[model samples]
Target chain A: MLIKSLAAEWLKMRKSYIWSILAALPAVSILIGTANYYANKSVLTNGWYSLWTQVSLFYGEFFLPVLIAICCAYLCRLEHFNKNWYQVMTAPVSRSAIFISKLAIAGIMMLIVQAFFLLLYFCAGKVLGLASPFPIETVGWMSRGLYASIAISAVQLALSIRIRSFAVPIGISICAAFIGLGMYVMKLGMFYPYSLLTIGIGALSQESLTIAENGLFLAMNSLFIVIVSAIAIRYLSKRDVVA
Target chain B: MNAIVSTHNLSKRYGDAYRVNEVNLEVHEGEVYGFLGPNGAGKSTTLKMLLGLVKPSSGKVVVFGKEFDKNRLSILRQTGSLIESPSYYGHLTGLENMRIMQRLHDVPDKNVCEALKIVRLENHKDKKAGLYSLGMKQRLGIAMALIAFPKLLILDEPTNGLDPAGIGEIRELIKSLPQRYGITVLLSSHLLSEIEQIATSVGIISDGKLLFQGSMEALQSKSQPRIAIKTVDNETAHVLLYRQGFHSVIEDDALIVKEMNDEQTAFANRMLVQAGIDVIRIEERRKSLERIFLELTGKEKSL
Candidate 1:
């Protein structure tokens, strides 16, 4: 049942123009990051690591959260508009399958966006004539960034599913991102959902995480994803759908 | 015949008021059951509850002899529905929308083409559903519901937004479903003529309450013909007829006698004349089905 549900979701996803969003956000972030790096190159001694901090700073803190919100909202936009929820709720599929399929699709789109961001980063480093060898830790940044993104996607998906307006969920995500930055400054980044992205990507700082710190990061994100997804599925199963 | 779907004391409330109150509905096999109501009469809400789209505030629904809550997916597999407005993705083509339904229904691909052809949308299958005209979009919704070839089909205002010709086509298609495909349909509409033309059984609802439920013949029987007598002295004629065992009431300057056949009409006129009432005219008036519907729904003044 889940496989069939996933197939249906894939069909809807493929026909939409969502790929353009996945490609555009990362490229724009790179442009802004490159400009800021050039302006401050005199003070920044580390070649590739300094660029990593600059690029990932904007990507993880603001653009990525907004991007995740957009993707999750788009997945649910079709159902919310024109009373399509009537059809989906009546379809011969389990509610769990429907919710999980949408989450899976959002996760897949995030993966694509992350990969493109890394590719743009590599190209930007080569273009800047960096003398130092490629920083291998940046790969860790990409992988951890993907993990945090999935948790954000789960929360955003729940918000999008409950609220009908397309812009409301995205607007809420922007506010959450700012709060996440404040939490990171207080050294409580490991607890908040939005702060996890900044810490995972080492956006504000490029120092490698200690082994215990890395374990805490993975465990916290997993907990958030599980809790948000559980609440979403329960709400869907119990509440009457508005069509 | 066995009932394909039945709801026991089904009710839905919003805040303090009831949207659908104690609506006990029974739809039999292989028959077109017309659910009749005026606007805001809770027809759509009732249908939504049956399809499990809206959870009822109280009561239970049984489909195919199984409880709906416990066997929702299994029951839904045998049921096809298009509730309220039609639902379709504006960006996807009509065929693609049907394909999504096909995958969820786990039916063969050929069924999608066949269902589209049934609704006469095969030619416009590639057009985006949002771009299609209102009538075309309605047809696409019906086609998607039919792709699964469900045994029980529920439609709320299916003929809405269709031109006369399109309405006729869909009406005939729905009317033929029982004999052609053994499909039992529960359709809701505000139009009395539509139900009269297509329904084998009728359920009328008004103000969140069901006023009547029975076969079409039973509903028509409520509109029996009557004899109207216009006499020079209607007041005396009414009393005389009543004394003579004729139940009559004076309305519109005439004595109206209900459920009177040809023989009774002649006898009543003759008796009135013999009593020196000086009958001026005798007329047979059959209450129209629309008037009965309006009267039962308490909207007689609107007529």
Candidate 2:
């Protein structure tokens, strides 16, 4: 039943314009980051790591959270469009399957976007004639970034599922992203969903996390995902959803 | 016949007021049950509760002899429904939409094509559902509901967006489903005439309450025929009939006798004529089904 539910969700994702979003955000961020790196080549001597700070700054702080929100909202937009919730809720499937399947799809989308952003980063470095070898720590950044993204997707998916308006959830994500910036400045990044993205991507600081810090980061993200998903599934099961 | 679906005191409340107040619906196997009501009569809420789309505030739903709360998925597996408006992905083609339902229900791929053909949407199957006309969208919704070959079909205003010809076609299709495939249907409509043409049994709701529930013949039987007698003097004729143990009332300048048969009409006319009263007119008027529906719905003032 979960497989079938996943397939149903995947079927709706077909022919949608979501790919354009996945491609545009990272591409535009690379453009701005490369320009900033070239303009600051006088004093910056950290090579690829320096470029990472510049590129991930806009992508992680603002664009990435907004991207997750848009993707989650778009995933639910079809169901909220014309009473499609009635059809899906009445289907012979568990509510957990439906909620989990959407979260999975959002995770997959974020994975693709993360990989694309890394590819663009590498290409930008190569194009700049940077002689330093690619930083191995960047791969760790990408994986952690994807994990944090899935956590954010889970929360956004819950909001999108409850609210019918497409723009409202996305707007809330924007506001939350700003608050996350404040939390990151206070060294409370691991406690908030949006700030986790900033810290995971090393958007402002490219330094590596200690072994204990890495463990806490992963644990915190998992905790948020589980709690948010549980609340969403419970609400879906108990509430009445009209067409 | 066994009841394919039944609700025991099902109710839904919003805040302090009830949207559906203790609606007990019984839909039997091999019969088309029409849920008749005026607008905002809680028809949709009651239907949603039956399908588990809406949670009942204080009651339970039983389908196929199993409680809905305990066996929702299993019960829903055998029931197909199109509630309120048609639901579809505007981006996908009609065929694609049907295929999704087919996969969810775990039916064969061929069932998709067959269901489309049943709704006469086979030719337009490749068109995006959003671009289809309102009637076509409605047909596609019905096709998707039928794709799984569910034993119990619940349709709320299935013919809502169709033209006259399209409405007639769907009406015929729904009427044939029971005999053709043994699918019992629970259909809802605000039009009494629509229910009259399609339903074998009926349940009428008003103000969130089930006003009446019985066979079509039973509802029709409520429309008793009365004898209206017009004489040279209606006042005297009314008194004379009252004295003869005939309960009558004067209305519209005629003496109205309630629930009179052919023999009673003949006897009353003969008695009036021999009493030196000129029997100008003796007409039998059967109350219309529409009037009875209005009265049950508490909208008789509009008539």
lDDT digits (tens) for residues B119-204 of candidate 1: 99999999999999999999999998898889999999999999999999999999999998899999999999999999999999
In DockQ, how does model 1 score against the reference complex? 0.86
- Candidate 2 local lDDT, B178-255, one digit each (tens): 999899999999999999999999999998999999999999999998889999988888888888788988888888
- All candidates: DockQ: 0.86, 0.85
Candidate 2: where is the Cα deviation over 4 Å?
A: none
Give fnat for candidates 1, 2 and onward, in order.
0.84, 0.78
- Candidate 1 segments whose C-alpha is farther than 4 A from its true place: B275-278, B301-303
Task: Give DockQ: model 2.
Answer: 0.85
Which CAPRI quality tier does the interface of model 1 achieve? high
lDDT of 2 at B117: 94
For candidate 2, the per-residue lDDT at B263 reads: 85
Local distance difference test, each candidate: 0.93, 0.92
Give me the displacement of residue A70 in model 2, in angstroms.
0.3
